[model samples]
Target: MSMTEAQTTTRKQALGSPLDRADGRLKIQGLATYAIEKSLENMAYAVVVQSTIPHGRIRSMNIERARQSPGILAVYNHHSGLIIHPAKTFGQGGAAAQAFLPLQDDKVLWNGQHIALVVAETLEQATEAAALIETEYEQQAAIVHPDNPDARPETVDALTIEWGDAVPALAQAEVQIGGVYTTPREYNSPIEPHGCIAHWQDGSLTLWEPSQWVGGARQVVSEWMAIDREKVRVISPYVGGGFGCKGGIQPHSALACVAARELKRPVKLALTRPQTFTAFGGRPRTHQQLALGASRDGTLQSIVHDSWNETALNDVHKEPCNAVTPLMYASPNFLSHHKLIHLNTVNPSWMRAPGENPSAFALEVAMDELAWALKMDPLALRLKNYAEQDPQAKIPWSSRQLREAYQQGADAFGWSKRPLEPRSLREGRQLIGWGMASGTYPVRRTPGEAQIVLYADGRLEVQSSGVDIGTGTYTILAQTAADVLLVAPESITVLLGDTLLPRAPVAGGSQLANLLTGAVHKTALALRDMLITLAVSTEKSPLWQQSPAALALADGFLWLSDKPNLRVSFSELLRLSGNDKLIAHQDTFATTASEDDRNKADSTSSMMVPPTEGGVSAHSWSAIFVEVAVDEDFGTVRVKRMVGAFDSGRIYNPKLTESQWIGGMVMGIGQALLEEGAIDDRDGRITNANLADYLVAVNADIPELTTIDVGKPDYLATVLGGKAVGELGIVGVAAAISNAVWHATGKRIRDLPITQDKLL
Candidate 1:
């Protein structure tokens, strides 16, 4: 529990400098252990048996062949020894992507539903035994698509928004545009497909899973298993990637524990790449209809966004497709409807930038169409509709710099030199065009706890169960601690990815950094205050004569505020006090601003109001500019380059922030040019489940990327002045690329994956 005395330093890392990950050496040396790579004394492997039929009852069960297979210990069906509890939503503070439990009955709700599990001594045996299991089903007609005559889609009241009538206002506008845009279902496609290792002993269960929220996982796994919360332990030390797919505990995670407990052995379940498509979750396919009405001067008069998304047979999770419509633009009369259509498909769930990614393709393209009707520049149209305050929240914005982002982006991308008409600009044997779109994702914050310990030797340790899904959690926290403690990065050690550590919010929704920093900020300040108190508490020390109120911390010393040279180092003071280490723990609640800042400055968004009035709306904004080249004869579109100017509150580490932006652009390129999850209507199976059949972008597809930040810190979002950049770069990327393709070829493809056929 104590660091060595030789392991401390008093130098600090530069705030804007990039820091390499602390685990880089461990990973490169093959010493890092993933969930599937952990070895135990005796471990069993499990493979799930999926339902062949979309909807119906299992008429006859046939598990004799699988039960008799070599090394097969058990083949469990609904009537087997396995007992499971139905899914329940965690509380507001708890993290869960969805609440649909599996394997509770013999009725098949959808194809690829996990109906049975085969546990064996080896992975080969488990896989072979799973393939041998077969069942007879009473086939029933399935609802494959929402367009079916009998299909009924229900509008979600909570998701739908209405204000002044949008119907009449649309009819009265001088310029109007109506169009339908469709985005295909997509997979999470993290390199590390979901894998779990479950062990149970003495009525307690332990799971090593790559979950985004270990605390939430413990809560759910405990509840579903009828056990105490403390009895369940979850560990996710280093996640390969989440992208919202592994944000919570999936049903397979529980199944592994169930099988492990039943067989009295550790169970390991690893999903194959094919199973990754339908085993857990994927982004729902969307059909978005937009009607944009604008004045002759290109100001929005009205806007309505109607969406119908695919859902599973009984799953009621709603994709917030209309979420962006309420916050993005200025429209007096707005109507947004989100309807869920029942389909015989796997349960659809969140992907990166879930609603905003696909929704932007529809709304931004409609805005472009309105711009053409009004004969206005696209960027000019966006500036005309800039919202000073949140449209739906009706609250003052904490911080907004979208206008500056647009101006900076346009200047960098050479917007003034581009031809206004599509197909008017050309290169040798190719047509060149430029286009742009605005992007935004809300700045979300959550409550968290951090534990800090400062030793007599001057070393520090910070602990939290924060999962690092390759978003630089380790490096950023080290930088934060170094900056706060006035110590070198080597002196600060961050311990996370364990359930026993302090609980942290899930690492999705772009919230972890903002929320984690708040906790760290509060905890470090508490440690500093405690040190000041300890240094002046008694008359035995030099600082005992000085008041604690007049002390300032610099280089691990508490000195008089007015006299820089009069100081006593913490090490010497602690040595004299006969204490080895100082400990402090703090839980922070996210507020609009720091107490000092709130008490001092007046808050303003659209109107000036008292700073402490209420919480504020926070959003990270970007203006994406893209250039594309279309082969005139072949009808192929290629992105030549991309430039994005973002106005996220503060840049914690500019290098990591730029890396995240480039990765998001690559993901957007995949969405615009290639990436689609195909389904077979005949049997409801995911077609092209494997990578060989389903394509993603490779190194050859990546284009030159340029990411620049406005570089202004806004304290309103958080006292640290940092906004989330995780999902900010992913939104609006597809729309920007698609808009550029239209500008190059003079053909607008509303459907996603603007493929070669769509180009022609």
Candidate 2:
């Protein structure tokens, strides 16, 4: 079958069906409980006090006023001697977004640093008393931007990739395109803010919070409170949204725990709108330089990409903006390097797509410039440099259909009608243009475990510590289990985001579906095999000596495929065997890893790197086509429409997958034309800290959007034969929109947020 054709499997396949979210009713009716809503008896509200100075040391703190305020239970500051330890940073294989623990001392690292906490009987009282707590500070000069003279950048050797020399290759090439591109600092801005409720009872702590990794959060809290790991229980069944900010433990969780322990009662702390912007990390500002060399025939010969991003003074978080340059296209000589600029800012965390999102904007736009320079079609140019295998690893891909995606997307978007010349197509006051770009993201899988139980009454239960994060975890897992047992999805119940469940990894990097689906599928199969053994061994069962391969299980009945009349219900079989339930557990590893990788992960608590088979690479691919209408007078750009074709192996649920794609594309539109987290240089404070000021793509900004799924199942990638699609949808969208703007106005804007001022 052609790789371009989407799988024609029906609901019976269970993997590619467009199943509705199982938790839809509960969520729509507001019955689903969130972190802050997990109220406990006699819960006291806690409000965090932030430092006004970016860099400072507390000279003195006066909590007497707060202590005398109405309904005030207690007020604590740095001198309160809170028993908290800094968690291991996420990059170091622990749960914290930043390694720095706040409130340990008087030295303030940045503006909005948690200086104190006020506990009151009500939220309003806590907020009022928190404002009354005063503090004097001794300020120091701070460096908040990379452009500052005091800023010093350090080269990251681990992220650097060098192959054949690119400088000499570029100079001798038949054509070259070089330019600087930049993207501003952006926040996650999830619908739900980061919050937590901490309760300590019977020498055990229970935390209700929004987290992408409940297990990791439990570990962090246990380590910080000096409690046993088993004594810490984290529960987050439903999260409003968590792009990446809530993926790990934040300082607020620690503070809430401390307050609860000190006051001997449950403590609730929910970050305010402005506090959400200041308390958590976001995508750092990036400056990238890209140069591409190609032959006169539009074949890429050399590529050089160097990038720099801001980081906190103490925490070094570098953005690998050039990571996609080596993976996207085929080039004989390439150089990709990264650097980190130390500044007084919130340490950056993973946003949707993280490095790849900004990286593709620069790389793809550069490719578009090269295509224009060569007087060639953009899509044709990409085809000429298409990578048949991993250019660096020199191996075959597990499954790749990027070329087919381009072809299908182009046909649907009417790319053949796009004029070759820029600013040629016009409609009244609008200059119309169409542009396209290719996107790619690596497919990585980690270790996960699951548990499944089946009762004689035909009830199925699946449990895992993985989180939904609004990606339809409940629905997909049900489908996967139903596929194996030949049961209806409604009969299966999925429980997730609890420490009591089986172990699972963080729900980032698009790995949850790849890991959990495999776990459920394998566990369900194991249960089936166990039941088949019981039936074959018992003489009371019909066709006791029947071969397992010749029998099929469906709707809680076991029968011979060739003799349907000879059937046995699961309840009857269990009753005869004097068993009430059947249970199975499975540990899943999506990829094979070497001993060294395993040892490294074990020793450093870092993520495991799975070695490929012989030399194979796995990646999800997409082709994005966009149309934009540029106003001739106002210089404003409006996206007319967008179409994306994706090759992500077998899409587990088309409805959820398309939602993710459309959401990503909308974020991309914001990145290209609206979003920016402005900062006050003097105080290292965010100027636009609220949603009203921080522009995002609203319903009015998004035009008609369409997505196409195309690919065959890739067994080589994983047992489920599905790659990660969470990050792939947003990879090259900014570049496609930027390219469209250029095509419409003949003006190339390298900087992001192509505002009307830049165009005018």
Off by over 4 Å in 2: 1-13, 539-547, 590-605, 610-614
Query: Compared with the true structure, what per-residue lDDT tens digits does model 2 show for residues 347-424?
Result: 888898888888999999999999999999999999998899988778899899998899999999999999889999
Residue 420 of candidate 1: its Cα lDDT? 77
Clashing pairs in 2: none
- Which stretches of candidate 1 lie above 4 Å from their native place? 1-14, 90-98, 538-544, 549-575, 590-615
Candidate 1: RMSD to truth = 5.3
Q: What local distance difference test score does each model get?
A: 0.79, 0.86
Locate the minimum summed-lDDT window of 10 residues in model 1: 599-608
Candidate achieving the largest TM-score = 2
What is candidate 1's lDDT per residue for 1-760, written digit by digit as tens?
Answer: 1121212333325345677767777788988687778788799999988887778888878999999999999888887857767545432223444455666677887778888899999999999989887899998888877777767988888788988889899999888899999988888798888989999999999999987778778777876788987798888888888788887678888789899989889999998888888786688889989999988888888988899888877765567778677778999999989998988777787788877777777888888777777878899899899999988878888888898889888898898887878888899989997889888887766556788888888778888887788888777777776666665665678888888888676787787787677778678888888888888884566778688888877566767777756767888878877889888887664355464332111110111122223567878888899999999888888889999989888888788888888888888899888899887878788889988878888898888899989847868876688886988888888888888888888898899888988877
